[model samples]
Target: MAHFVPRASFSLPGSIPKTYFLGHHHSGANAIKGILNTINLVIECRDVRLPLSTQNPKLESLVAGRQRLIVYTKSDLCTDSPAATHTLRGLYGADNVLFWDKHRPGTTGALLRKLKNSARAIDALTGLRIIVVGMPNVGKSTLLNALRSAASPEKKAKAAKTGDQAGVTRKVGTSVRIVDSEEKGGVSGGIYLLDTPGIFQPYVEDGETMIKVALAHGIKKGLIADEILVDYLLYRMNHWNPGLYSRYCEPTNDVNEFLTAVAKRDGKLKAGGAANWQEAAARVLSLWRIGKFGRYVLDDLSDEAIRAHQHLLVNPHLSQNQAKKLQREERRRARTGD
Candidate 1:
């Protein structure tokens, strides 16, 4: 029997979109900037699975010069990449980066303590104002609700609307008090947090970044076909550890073979017992999202990848106008096959 070998590289389809910038994303950026003056601390939420891809360069510029706390949400989903946390903390500051999981109250408590400490330092009568911002579906609203629930146990209801898909919170929300005044042993004036809509970058030059973002549901659903996503996922799984999907089948580069096995095992079959590839792909994605298959970070965390990412953040390859022009050229090429 021959030993299984994964493909050295996954070819990206040109059909993948380079941007998912919606009307809400544009308005959300402007709204966040409009209120930047009133904000004391910015809570930037990012998915633990795709930390680098989830970081919006536009948001970084908007929140520049402000005290920012980088909270990696859904940390439980990337437990396999323990070094990712340490590496991120080293890049940012040990005090600036926090790994958070909604299920873990200890993590939430740690974040609450940080917020309270910041509030104490400010000692503001108007309260320490904070705004939660991040890419779509990265859990900005979810984090806000968690912090609110942790700080104020009496408030059981969620303050911001949340959903699995992107663009759930379209508009900026009113201020929700997370802590009480000094008399109540909270902060000086108390701590308040404003939840903003998730903002996507104006342009994503790398197709792989878009795919990773899509896998994390950072973009609108159906932007990229589920089959394509699962294929990319299968490639990654093979590289990480072929046994990640061993229950379905042996490691193979063919996405159909894997999806067929999944359909048979999970009962995603058509009337005539045909493998429902679409449904199977979605099932795999759902399972991965909940950390069933494996918990791992999608971004390349090697020293080189990190340095390249940092460099790109500091010096973007193209301006907004240039990006638009490049997108237009790509679309024309797609149409004419030039």
Candidate 2:
């Protein structure tokens, strides 16, 4: 007869990786910097589910002086957090933050209009050149294709290659025209966008951020085990609403029990009827990614969380060193049992 309550905190595993930075990511950053002088604007994309986690601090610094617009891609997946848009707009002025949904043409139109306005202001002889950049798998290519399609209705074929997994576009793509010139009722010189490979931060001091990024498919699949990711998902779902998973079973802290119920309901089982936890975990993740369970924002958007995030961005080195020192102290305490 007792009501269910979610845990106040989820313990992160010690094995959680602090970095997903690869060789391609480094090269991608350098490539963006190389073309900074030519780029008139930067369309920085972040997954709505993990706005903070998907932000690459290094990339931000590289393109700091340029005109930037923070587009939260997959906004449809964060409908559960209705106020998330307002909060984000408040953090980074309303004009600077945009919630974009590929499914909604209106959202794409809004972005196109903004791009055209920027192009009109510059009145470049060649064209308004923009570069799309973001963390891995945050929908940079997809956004480029969407903009191109929206601007040029007759162009049926996609200009940029898009995939759900990370590293789909390993190199910088050539410039693709998204708008026509003034005679065609478009911007002054036309609008072109360059799609760049998603670049990950050099290091992530917080393991929880790694888990969140992994859940959003920003990092390579299986970098963190599906089971571990699912556990984190379960914890977050519980905190939001146990009813989010009511279709499977009663809310419980036991990931095994939850996965077993999911396996049985969804037929993710072994030949002998035993639960296939891995497959079940994957299924859960796939469903959540598409917003079957609930459309929620994983990052904490409260005032305190925002302030901490801003502080870290301002003093990244200090935060990283402090985090390392604390990690060392934690390990030492475990060894000493004090």
Candidate 3:
């Protein structure tokens, strides 16, 4: 494990041919950072989560002179696809872009094909080993699994089910090849993959807050699912399902008011006709999880905030030289009104 490095520390990881996935929270940042900060062959991975999508410009600097694959994970659910694709391409160019489904198992073949092609292209000239890095839970493990399975059939068993979460595949590897023994695309020949845990930075939270954080990053533009998520919880408290009473469950309707009605119906009333609000909301969260509320994506941050976040990611460690250069450029532009 990497020592707890301060967020602002800009020291590039030791010289290793690797890839780095950059972002705010996990999703794809933590794992990529680990590979870059420790191993060589690393380039960089961009956290395409809703919040941090276009939020970081310094991210471009991290991918300099390395093989990069723009992974659009959770593509099935995101409301904005074309815009995201365009934004990333506009910034990183179309050559590096790619997409992935978090739950799908077959996409790995497509990815490996692309990687091999890229490696072959770059290998013909310069560069070292290639590293696939990304934020946690951005399908790195799944990608590794698909790669492994694609390489070797016997070694590629279905994901182990423990309970509500995933079971670890111990046979995989400690620090060797990524997809060691598969079949056609097996790592035995050359290609490899490294899987890392989901990254949960200080800013990440579960449930509704998690959605909000993602939106704040500019990873996704606009999603009605977020309000829908909170709405479902609020709706169920009032003894109604989401979208069943669209007008009544409008965003303007007060959540606390909805809680009151829920409390009265659920016998959470106080001494008088008034109902307990907090208790009702808590119960609503439970019910919502149980399908009382429909699936929803909470895009918390607005477009304006995302713009600011993008600005900060780029200027986080602005050096004195950069600052002076920027100041000079600004002054020159101002004088010329250009």
Candidate 4:
């Protein structure tokens, strides 16, 4: 087994509690999977931007055979209605799912009501330990703060000291437990939330994989929302997502032609009648940040993980590393049909 590292250390009040959080893909997938290997019923942030197929099974396995709820976090930003979010619960099974938006200061939406309703649904489990998990800037920290605030009326939760800047919650995750939620005016029940660092594609030799996680979480798009942000994302994603050539009328084969066309279109040509190729390159990057290129999937679909999944398919019982080493064994089995 790869040695597990603690993202954030919890203040575990009594014996390590049972309840936890759940999330799939980009950040929380693998570790949430590890948590599911232990217990049931975790609190998870809902990211509609990510498709179900891309969600890592480590987290999904936990959702099966027990109670699960979906918090439609950042619902304020969604183009969908509260009724639309509610329909998902019906589709997933009435009691199986729920939605909430911690982004809104007050819990006015259906999901907040659902989280409040979760208590009545599962009467026996009073102290629900929630492992609220998600990627950075997807509001994992923000959700926890809101939940903490709603629960306590006086002296609400102090902001968890995370940065508003991108990738601020770096390093092994650290968690803060709401040991006392009675004051938050929430149902006076037993619940402790563990916050974790946003997961990302691990480095092989460089940060190439991390850019994929950034893409999955909409951080790149967010950065592009501003004119300056557009420039940054364009620079990175131009080489990152070569589909840029087709998006605008530009030469696909020649990098120079593509850059020149982008500058000419933006009317940023040099006084010497030369295409401002440098500026064009900058413009392309800006467009992606600004969402002109359209949404695309970029996560830990790296070669290493794909290879690992394929290896697991053959050696159903081998450990992740052992399976990688047993490639010759696989070849032998393939040759012998044993």
Best by lDDT: 1
Between candidates 2 and 3, which one is better according to TM-score? 2
Error of 1 at 136 (Å): 0.5
Off by over 4 Å in 4: 1-40, 62-64, 72-91, 94-109, 120-126, 134-138, 150-158, 161-185, 199-214, 217-338
Clash count, one per candidate: 0, 0, 41, 25
- Model 4 score (lDDT): 0.45
Error of 3 at 131 (Å): 3.7
TM-score of 1: 0.95
lDDT by candidate, in order shown: 0.91, 0.88, 0.43, 0.45
Give candidate 2 misplaced runs (Cα > 4 Å): 317-338
Candidate no. 2 TM-score: 0.93
- Report the C-alpha lDDT of model 4 over 250-287, residue by residue, as the tens digit: 32434465566677778769998789766675666545
User: TM-scores of all models?
Assistant: 0.95, 0.93, 0.50, 0.48
Ranking by lDDT: 1, 2, 4, 3
- Give the range of the ten consecutive residues with the poorest summed lDDT in model 4: 15-24
**Residue 262 in candidate 2, Cα distance off native in Å:** 0.6
Candidate 2: tens digits of C-alpha lDDT, residues 1-338: 47888878889889886766676877888898998899889999999999888877888799888889999999999999999999999988999989999999999999999998899889988889999999998999999999999888899999988898999999999999899888888878899999999998867758899999999888888878999999999999998889999999999988999999999999999999999999999999999999988999999999999888878877775465665565455445445645
State the displacement of the C-alpha of residue 247, model 3, in Å, after optimal TM-score superposition.
10
Evaluate model 4: give its TM-score.
0.48
Candidate 1 per-residue lDDT, tens place, 248-329, comes to 9988999999999999999999999999999999999999999987899999989999889989987888887887666566
